[model samples]
Target: MTKQELKEYYWIRRNITKSEQRLIELETAATKITAQLKNKHDAIMGQGNTSDKVGNTVADMELVRDEMTEQIKRSYAVLAKLEKAIEELPAREGYLIRSRYIELLSWEQIAVDMNYSWKQIHRIHAEALHQLQ
Candidate 1:
């Protein structure tokens, strides 16, 4: 792969991590909303006007949850493709790609982990991209 292609892959991988985080946040929100709706459903008696408002709120939250679920599915699919592409690379290069992108590690952190200078890691990354093509 060209350097630019490899850079694109790296960005896509990074996006997967970000999307995964967003998925978690969305799911959490959905769960909270579900709980609130459940509580409101159970208390169906005194608060008549409040119940109508809660009904509308629950419907809106359900729509948001459905949208988030679809987004999470798409993110997973993209991440899978990027992962499969990196799987063909040599061990060191693949590790570097995963660390920097999928794992979302900083260059300094990756260098520390691999016991190499950050500059050397970048050099290796550039070389690795050639093999990817």
Candidate 2:
């Protein structure tokens, strides 16, 4: 790979990892929000003072939702960087490497999509990675 291509690949890899982490964080926050909402719903379902206590739960849920939204926005930023890097990749290797490695497609899947045998795909992928060094 040319120095520019290598730099692109490095940034793409970093962006992909960052996006994945952001997604994970979003998932975690969403889970917590869901649980909190569910508990709040259950509390409201119960008779008496339980319904009054829901204000705090609702506040917490909103905070979690806001956090998840921010994470999703940051994730989109990372995705934009990754997309630009992918566009800069060499014609011979960029698309395949970005789709397979950055997007996390399986070798067999990439082969089928690319109209190559799995073995050939593996070889080409190996060569692509080697060129980045």
Candidate 3:
């Protein structure tokens, strides 16, 4: 592959990780918002000390949650595309890509898992990228 194409491949591989983190962030925020809405709903209605604004807040949080869900879906699409590229590599190369990037393993860890020396594993990694290129 050309240098630019190789760089794009690497970028896509890394981008999946970034997208996953973003999905997690969206999910966590939605969870927090859901909890806050529930708490406010209970406190307002249960105490018979209700505020109209609390209802508004609940509606707002629901809207936020919906938007977050859409963003999470888009992030998954990005992940799927990256995984497709990785899958195109030879089996061993694919495994290396998945382990190193998707699973976020260290080079030493990958070497251990593959039952190969660290230097050999690094060599294989380079070869894998070359094949894609």
Top TM-score model: 3
Per-residue lDDT tens digits for candidate 1, residues 36-133, read 77777757647677777766776776677677677767766765766787898888889998787657689999999988998999988887777767
Model 2, span 9-37: residue lDDT tens: 44555765675676667567657766775
The TM-score obtained by model 1 is 0.56
RMSD in angstroms, all models?
4.8, 8.3, 6.4
lDDT score, candidate 2, position 7: 39
How high is each candidate's TM-score? Answer: 0.56, 0.46, 0.58
* Candidate 3 local lDDT, 1-133, one digit each (tens): 3334433445665665665666576567657766776777757666653545555555665676577566657656766766677789899988987787667689999999999999999888888878766
lDDT order, best first, reads 1, 3, 2
lDDT of each: 0.74, 0.65, 0.70
Better of 2 and 3 by lDDT: 3
